[model samples]
Target: MTNDQRDPADRPRSWPYAAAAYVFAVVMVGTTLPTPLYGLYQEEIGFSSLMVTVIFAVYAAGVIAVLMVAGGVSDVLGRRPVLLAGLGCAAASALCFLFEGGLPLLFAGRVLSGFSAGLFTGTATVAVMELAPRHRRGRASFAATAANMLGLGCGPLLAGLLAQYAPWPLRLPYLVHLGLAAVATCLTLVLPETVRHAGPRPALRPRRPSVPAGTRSVFIPAALAAFAGFAMFGLFTSVAPSFMAQTLGVHNLAVSGLVVFLTFAASTVGQASLGGVPAERALPLGCFVLVAGLAAIGGSLLATSLALLVAGAVVAGVGQGLLFRAGLSAVSARAPADRRGETTSAFFVVAYLGISLPVVGVGALSLALGLRDAGLVFSACAMVLAGSIGIWLLRAVPRRPRPGA
Candidate 1:
């Protein structure tokens, strides 16, 4: 039987997929909840900017590790178990934050968040898409992807507001998430399973990520587009606050959160814009736009203009939104039916690496030359990489006939 052709017992009748999408979003929301609060952590723990990146990198390390070892387990054991494991890790992460005293707890919390997200990243997207009726696949895709970006966008905004206005700056946000996660866990319990397997439970083992035969050529450009876009995410989530404080003289946590929020919001707008353009066109164009956004960011640093910074973030976010969604959608379409999970996990490993490695490089550079110069180097390198991807796509991928005739 096909993956989507499940028995009636496993099929949810009334919007279970929608409910799952919300759960997916909430899980993702927890992953970035620390973005705006990193500044406060630095104050409480007395760490360098480099240490902050290290903390975030730990989260990415957990994510990549999970992607490698356990990412495809959902296909065998069942989605519910994998998702429950993810949520459990998320709750543990929240607890770590609630009791956070120093770097160890902080690192532990982020690593848990990473594991949670890695579990959810491919499973939730595939589950939501498969659960939908054939006619509603498009809307389900939107629900899945939108939930991700919107949830990520909401994380900092929620945290920033609570941290700025509420007591227990570090504690309250995670508390709220913990409550939400409890509710989500209950909901997940009732949601019908979408993957049906009749064999003994598959052993969990470390597996390498690979593309299906004939898909490797397409996979490269798609992975590259996702990498470039996620690099934008790494910058925004990791150091946008520092940029605002030291470079632009802005200290409002809410304002800083809003800046990060706008980038993801712009990404959603970019995804919404994908309707008119073909995937091939959208993918390459999105990369080009990402390069442009980085150029704007480079200019923003040189000028010390907050407005330009915001503009760059929004622009880059839109590009990221378009490129990533387009790339994933295209790659999914080409992946062999059975190995789809492996293929998607591989793509995400690249994307998450983008989010982790480049930001660490920037953090290292900051310790040496300073934030502004490091930012300039960061932007220049991003532009070079993004530009190369765009040019390669245009040349390697065949051009489609223009929309009309």
Candidate 2:
């Protein structure tokens, strides 16, 4: 068949999508660069555990704000512009950290990082998918997700090692990220615009979160699973370091970062492992695994055993990976094609809430009961929620894959 007559899916994809994935990774790296350094910030700045959670939550707030308000701006503004804007936010966030002014700058940096993340999360994923050759779309999707988790995983690892062994513990990691962001910016500039608008630019506006009437049943369980999984992530990123230093007496910054990275790495693996599990069974199974991981975490806290803590993180991370991907896939499948994007946004808002709100609660609990106790409470609560959601899914959803499968 002639080129015009051939299926568009058969068309060759350019290299820009790969470059776009790299850009996505770089921006995400900035979002969590400070994870391992939070303890350092606390010591140098003299903040309470509550303040640390607040700082981390501020980033999530920025992310949710942008996700709710301007999530779809790329469809209107074009992918390149939105991506560059995200990179700008990331650079600004890095600069905020590099300057080291105090609590205000830390908060500002995190919020800016959140804005960058919020902007990147939807836009970059779409950009990667849109730019890829139709045949390579599956790989593109995996690339987008892997970039996100791996980038997030790498941040703590990078920051921790640098801070622990290198000079300028607080400043160096951000500086390195700043250099990477500049490179990502150059890449974004060159990437072909994936959104092809014919006439004048449409006015950018907020898209309210919506769940179609038909998909509500699947949406709730999937969203809750995502919430539980992200809550685990939030716990690790925000407070795990403090727990390591104060309760465990494990002050090696690199090890702390390594533990967080292991969870994310496990999550990436879990996402990859999803193809093996029947789609119908993925969510419930993931929840059970997550509960087990959370239980291990709680045990680690009670015993102050670092080995068990790492084991729990890896297990929970895998569960999180499975729960997040499976829930997302099921929801997207069930959602009306026209409303799929809207539904996914709503799901993410819930997921980000899991990451932010619960961590803050842990922070509050820490003030009254202490960090170890706070963690145990958090883990037990997460386990219960995950377990409940898993059981419900098993009962309500069928044993076999639905129509889409």
Candidate 3:
């Protein structure tokens, strides 16, 4: 149904929608809380740098697997239940981290975290939009997206500060998240469900992600932008801390976490800045900015300059923020309501692949080329991909026609 056709009762509840966003934010914060702690994990566990990426890759594996198999489950079962289940995953992940025994528990925690992220990434986003009034759709998108970045950024910052000053570096961060997750889980119980009709729940089955024929013009470029943007994300979240501590000689855990936080903060700013941008222009413009940011990252790595590195991260974050939000918003705008969930799943499947596969490749390359050189290589690859996406969006695809045009 069109926005006008939505049930009157479904009209956005501003406060409740904000509440849902907060719940989602809390869950995401758990996913990235370990960003700066990887170094400590490496030191305490006696693992190689390649092992670090492999551990992170395991988390991405869980996310990709869940996205493929169950990405549409919230639509089938009820948003709150699936979301609550996600919160459970978040809490379980925290517990895993709090009681980490060795590599095995660490792996388990990341996998559970991934499951939580995969469950919420698309599902929570759509739920927030669904809860918004017709006019607040844009704000809903912003709220969901910003909450994601905000939570993700905060996780590391909180962890970094606590790890730096607290008695139990590893245990306290996850402990704090456990409390937050419990609070979020309770808050989630009160969110009004957005899915209607109360039909028997569909069987949880994995459908191969598919893009409708005509939407490819918009979808492909959008997905490519997501890939390039997420590749940068993979770099920062997985290996950037190690890069700083080992190659750049910045060993402060708080500083490392702050750098990651800044990248996400820039992304939130970029997403917010898109409010006035016309739909057709936002995607390509975002692609161009992503390329520019990738170049800065490459320069930072080559020069071994911390300032340049942070600059690269901020620029990349902005581009990534713009690219992903614009891409998702555009894709959702063109989808038939019946198939919107499936289409969204497909978009994320591609996007998550971007996040994972290339990151693992960097890890493998780091084994041979070393971390700094490997990062430079990733930068070049992502820059080329980002540029190509921008060119394709500019030259080939027509804008999605306006509603009622």
Candidate 4:
């Protein structure tokens, strides 16, 4: 009997999409596990700030390369295989960190983590939604996104707390994640395959991101909003800790991690708050809120107020969440079923670019301009970009007629 023809009860334990999401979250936790430890790495390895961003940029490059080449592999090869491969990458990434000797290992771990995430991002999301009962598909989307953000948020918190108070700072976090990855691998093996295989596997190669021509109107705005929102995340992840340590005189590793956590936590809340709001409304509003958050963050930099920085992180995270979910939903809803994986991958390509490119600029600017001034410039540029997008969205999205008039 084919895998699909197997009895339902014979498959691994099922709970709508919970099993997939659990695996999803575990893998993602590994991706950002190094966030809080960059400072420690710097102390030990004696690298400049530019190297930090360069290391981070290498990870982004890996993600983009995978998305461009193998993003749709699950669509042909089946989700479970891709997921298992991703877990293998995660395991390898954890091992890299566990035995990291210097810059080479650090860079290898990050790029491996990127490859793992690139695989999981679109594949796991589609698997979750596909596995859910029809009625719960909407909730499944949220589940996938929440798992992504919450897992990303929790990594630093976990690492920060452990590194601050535990025995081994760098070694412990990856060790814990390695165990989690093992469990996720077992769970993924049992999870039923969502995509059916027909005959022999097709050769996978690099293919440009293609959205159905009809979906472009929806795809463009949503992708742009995602880019803007993720840029805020990239900034926080790459440089916020440094800002806290260097400028605000906050040296507590836990505090640094918490500040970053608050941003992603706020993003989760923002996404949940969208309940039934239309994308037309949510997208533009998200842009406006993001701009406000940027302005506040800029103000915090100028004033050197930690409170303001925390507040800005929270506000900006919320805005990022709002646009991220709304845009993802709009794009996923419009994408053709057969091409969902590639379309979703394309969307994430744009988002990851937003996260990587601007932050690299920040790192470069820090050399000539210093962290404070670099941050100020980034905030100003992002604010203008977000504000312009908001204005365009407002004009481009047609207003719905009043209920009766």
TM-score of each prediction:
0.94, 0.94, 0.92, 0.93
* Regions more than 4 Å wrong, model 4: 1-16, 133-135, 198-206, 400-405
TM-score of 1: 0.94
Q: For residues 71-176, could you state the per-residue lDDT of candidate 3 as single tens digits?
A: 8777667789999999999999999988887999999999999999999998898777777766677577788888899998988888888999888999999888
- Candidate 4 displacement at residue 366 in angstroms: 0.2
Clashing pairs in 4: none
Measured by TM-score, the strongest candidate is: 2
| Segments in model 3 whose C-alpha atoms lie over 4 Å from true places | 1-13, 133-137, 198-205, 397-405
Angstrom error at residue 383, model 4? 0.5
Clashes of each: 0, 0, 1, 0
Off by over 4 Å in 1: 1-4, 7-13, 133-135, 199-206, 399-405
Better of 2 and 4 by lDDT: 2
Worst 10 residues of 3 by lDDT: 1-10
List pairs with backbone clashes in candidate 1.
none
Worst 10 residues of 2 by lDDT: 1-10
What TM-score does model 3 achieve against the real structure?
0.92
lDDT of 2 at 299: 95
Expressed as tens digits, the lDDT of each residue in 1-405 for candidate 1 is: 423336433454647777888899899889889998999988887887877788888888999999988877787767888889999999999999999888788889999999999899888887777777655766777878888898898899889889999999989999999999999999899877877656555566767787887788888998988987898898889888988888999888889889999998899899988986777888989999999899999999999999999999999998998898889878988999778778988999999999999999999999998989989999999999999999888787676699897
Let me know the TM-score candidate 2 reaches against the reference structure.
Answer: 0.94
Residue-level error in angstroms, candidate 3, position 234: 0.6
Query: What would the C-alpha RMSD of candidate 4 be, to one decimal place?
Result: 2.7
